[model samples]
Target: MSDINNWVLPEGIEELLPDEALRLEKIRRDLIDLFASWGYQFVIPPLIEFLDSLLAGTNSELALQTFKLTDQISGKTLGIRADMTPQIARMAAHHIKKCDAPVRLSYLGTVLHARGAQIEKSRSPIQLGAELYGSQHIKSDVEIIQLMLEVLAVSAIQHVHLDLGHVGVYRGLAQQAGLTTSQEGELLDVLQRKSSDEVVELLETYKLDKKWVNVFVQLLQLNGDVTVLEQAKKVLKLGDASVQQAIEELQEIAALLQQSYPSLPLYFDLAELRCYRYQTGVVFAAFVPGFGSEIARGGRYDNLMIEQGEQVRSATGFSADLKVLTRLMAVILDEQAKEIILAPDVLDENLQGLIRELRTAGKTVIMQLPDSSKQPNHTALIAKVNDKWSVS
Candidate 1:
């Protein structure tokens, strides 16, 4: 029972065995190469930082996700970065300050959040994403989406969907509802969970225009294939300039992506609000089979430049969640686990170098069987005996 409090893995935490760990590392490397080819250099923000600094402009919900503590030397509150987006923002506004416009940076690191994250999420999960600075053109939006799709395809992730959204759409709706900020937050909470009863109760709290209420409820339900957009266009009713503008953006971006990647699936969700506070515009999340959350997510943020003390310059980009991608690959590998094994059964210096050379050249060589009696974890699988070598 002493094991109960020895700082071991708590429930919902996962420890990757060698095979799974190796596979995850390989997937991370492949994604890095994918981003590198597109000219995205890498940057790794520190895992721990002064809590207030890391949360410069983030929302409360995000702030609560952090795991905090006090630094011994400074006695100031510190926390693990909940996400890399804000840190990347800091970097653009500071470290890479000298770079030219449209700076493209990618990163691969584990982000630590509160332990109460969604059941499947590891409090520590590897994130692979990018931040594109200094451009807000529609072409930039289209390119970021295109890059996300390309990474997924190159990662061998098929049978997926890219659901797009605009926080602008929701902001306009909430404003039209004439509800207080708290009321709007309630409204968003209901829609975020897709709870019709809760949404109806909250809608009743405000004497909202019945027409707008119906349209709002309908938008929450509006999620599906290309046909959903047709239904959305009907309820949207040409009233919300923001919503209409967002739709036009979607159409333009979708057209560009389809021109280049006709096979890529694309659609929209007007009520989808993942990172509501941090993203200033056009947001998209990619979901592949067998993964719970988005495999990739990013959006535009022009206002961030103003906050960064730089003149507002629209920017947009996306990142593939390496943790999710790794999990999906593990599921795929488990379904096809059979693999060839190899060994050079001599316990000598020269033989060891040969084995090392084989591995360095990308050969999967296992030194021994798992059940071997003499030094089960020994480097080589078997030893020379009578001028020959054998495994037990």
Candidate 2:
């Protein structure tokens, strides 16, 4: 027997009802306005595009997560966007490539991934973010990080724990060790899983530079408070200039952020290269007390534009799922839901004028229909009292 609930949605797909949708929309507007205040122009990329354009220069893994179909008009493959960053990158490099100064762009839209990023996450997430292009200074990094902190503040996310890492620390060491791409990939995978034994096994199997191998092992233990930088310097004593420089960069960022947010909880994880493949430099993730997964994460990916055959420029940004934040808002917020004011179905000019005035003042006024049962719960009813209309 077929259990036919025709309205049932596919797994991981969802529809927002009136209250949830209203709250989500309000957050979106507030965030976009915040971005604008920071001088970031908003851009809307199409929901779908040609496959090549969609996945160009991104991690090969993204292809599997993308939904594909044959286009009838051009007989070419089209993809529903799994991520909007690539499209925004394309716009920055091609359509708006001529800007002399760094381009700061923000976006908010629905992205359909083939599967959820985590076990019970949404397949279609409202991706909200800002991207900065054309500057490589530590100032650029600090700006994006500060902006991200501000975003969390605006969303009312409390007790945020920030985890910071830099891929350049590992990349430079890998270069010095002369490890091949496959070897680097394997090591990155082991580090991401934080498996100490596997890392040792791989290091012994490769028999790479003794100094670099020791440093690699030390990375796993390098975590916690700003003091971790000092420990990193000692642990990576044999580290090359690039490694030293990466540490210094992290120190500067930490100092600036700490100075700004004295009470902010900050952690440093040297082996925290979760998105090592796509991220070229500094990477970060934000977590609250109860959430097992990161609420938001992003980092520097300067080479993305180069892959698209455009001049390489510095770029960094962060994105959070609006749906998740909305959930959090619901938990912490007690917003008073507005009620509709019932207006009688009278053709009197003064009654109609009064309803118009209330609506213009941002009140919700619903005209009572002929059927009383169809009327909404009346918070206030407009009645004809004497010659003027009054609320009863």
Candidate 3:
């Protein structure tokens, strides 16, 4: 209604100034190149799609975050993407020709969320990620995690703390205990919050055998260093074969990561069910010392393709907010130091040639207008010296 209101952007939405924009672009290009080196082909999915396709294979959390509208042309409900992972899955399943080998794809773009996460309050974030499809092996999971760490390294972020979990662990336990879907969902909620009293109360209400009760309780304390995995194997021995298999998969991946990144901090959390409804297997998130929440996260969603009505395929990937990465980058870009050449208003052919040469050599050149009173800030100036036009 007012001029001020017109300039005010929605909460959690932001615009980048010149310096920040330039730095973000540089980081984006560098990371894209990094993904390319790893044999990941880049993809550019649309910002909006039909609601059903956009929301396919994702959880209710994503659905709540998506902003919906009616498309006048098609008179169909459309949804702006709140997360690109599902779209990436769709592309891999339908667009790309089916191949036996895994399809590696990377994407970078802005995603709109109706509401922001509590820790990071940005509704509009530039999401950058890579996905490996068609492989169910632990090696693929490890590769995705390794690539996530490399992304942090490229952004100059250090001291990353990685938290790993397997949804299969809990899935197996619930199935073995014969808990109903509602009961499992309730338990998952309490476990994620580490609400000990509530967790105990719910398990007591379930009236399970002591072994089932004990294993469920132990899940809360199963978070710590790598040693927690050994404890999990022993405590969860009562679980079915699927439980043991999940633990073994985690162990194998942890061993590989420790061998490759010896100094990386790894924490095991059996109760960490991030993206639980969407993820089918191993889940992981990366955090730094000061950051209160994960800077990047992803997990295995082996059933996503099948749920989308396509052939079965395994998928794993991680996504980070490019805006956050730019903010946390250790190297500060000094845009002011960039050379800017100012050429005087002139009609001489030689002056034009020199301007062209400077521009061709990657210099920013500003030609002076005939009668303009405005003067731009420039780091250098083009002047005639000894009958020759030169930059000083």
Candidate 4:
């Protein structure tokens, strides 16, 4: 038999104590309020759902992270949601299928992952994000990015570095080069890790055009300030229209963000594909000083609704781990201060009436019991003074 005294929590699982839990709740509420102010409505998706529905469309990455189990009643596989984006996408597809363009939805929930995504990170994370459905316009992308920046700002995280990229650049090149799906996946893996020699070797193995291969090399090299955009335009001049259009969109969005937030530093990494599988177009991430990973990440995924058999809508959004943000902010959990009044044990009508008055006035009054030995820590004491009940 296992030793009962040797208590231990499962790895990657954690419990939040009172103060920490309260602080996290406060941050969650504040962020949701902020989302509401920006016209994003909140929705809570089920913590567990049908595996197929939960991991639908280009979500292999998410599927791997999800914890799956056979449902006792239905015998169907159910997965504890590893990512809430798909659930929100389904809702947008089925519930608001006929709604207007640009349906803004926000969600705050705990998503359970099979394993921690990073070292020292929780297996369960408080995911807070807003998604924009419909409208493929670049302005929509800009809006989501700006909202992400605002979220970080509201959390009191500063010195943010925004790294921007467009997956379309690479995806377009692969399509134009006629690389098979297997080949493309391998190349993407190489590119993500930035293995330059491997990328060269893989491209050469397929005998792709040397010019396009050079463009791939440039893709790896195109990481720096806004000047890299000019470099990309110059080096990838022979890219397809899709690639060109992607570059133009990045240029416009970067320029707009620079003009809007002159102080916020922006870096362009043409090869920075955070969510290459599902994310189709412009992708971005926000990082603060001293944090090794991105504080928040999001990009355009317009095909999600269409893949779920809903009307075609262009969408883009970002999500951040609220727990990470709260920690990074160094939030000091504070208990709500209440004016607690300790009342006398005597049940005289006058004393009761005085207690009632205090209670009615939003004061917390603790009436003492005659036989009780317990005492309450309070801000004030109610006692009879000069034949009148008064607080001292």
Model 1 over residues 298-334: C-alpha lDDT tens digits?
Answer: 8987676656566535667776656567666523555
TM-score for each predicted model, relative to the true structure: 0.83, 0.95, 0.95, 0.89
Error of 3 at 115 (Å): 1.4
Candidate 3 regions with alpha-carbon error over 4 angstroms: 95-97
Q: What is the C-alpha local distance difference test score of each model?
A: 0.73, 0.86, 0.90, 0.86
Clash counts per candidate, in order, are 4, 0, 0, 0
In model 4, state the lDDT of residue 305.
Answer: 78
Q: Encode model 4's per-residue lDDT on 1-392: one tens digit a residue.
A: 98987778878888888767767777888898999999999999999988887888756677789999999999999999988898898887875667765689999999998888887888988899999888888999999999999998888787899999999898988888888999988888888888788889988998988887877877899999988888888788777899889999999999899888998898999898868888889999998888889999999998887777877667789999988888877546445565778997886898999889989997889977788788867889988989998999
Which candidate should be chosen as best, given lDDT against the real structure? 3
Instruction: Report the CA-based lDDT of candidate 1 relative to the real structure.
Output: 0.73
In the range 1-392, model 2's lDDT, one tens digit per residue, is 66779879988999998778877887888898999999999999999999988999998789989999999999999999998998888888874467778899999999998987787899999998888888888878888888887877788778888999999898988877888999999999888888878888898899887777777888899999999999998888676899889999999999999899889889999988888888889999888987889888889998888877778567888888999888776244333556568998888899989998999998888888887767777678898878889777
lDDT of 1 at 74: 99
TM-score of 2: 0.95
Error of 4 at 301 (Å): 0.5
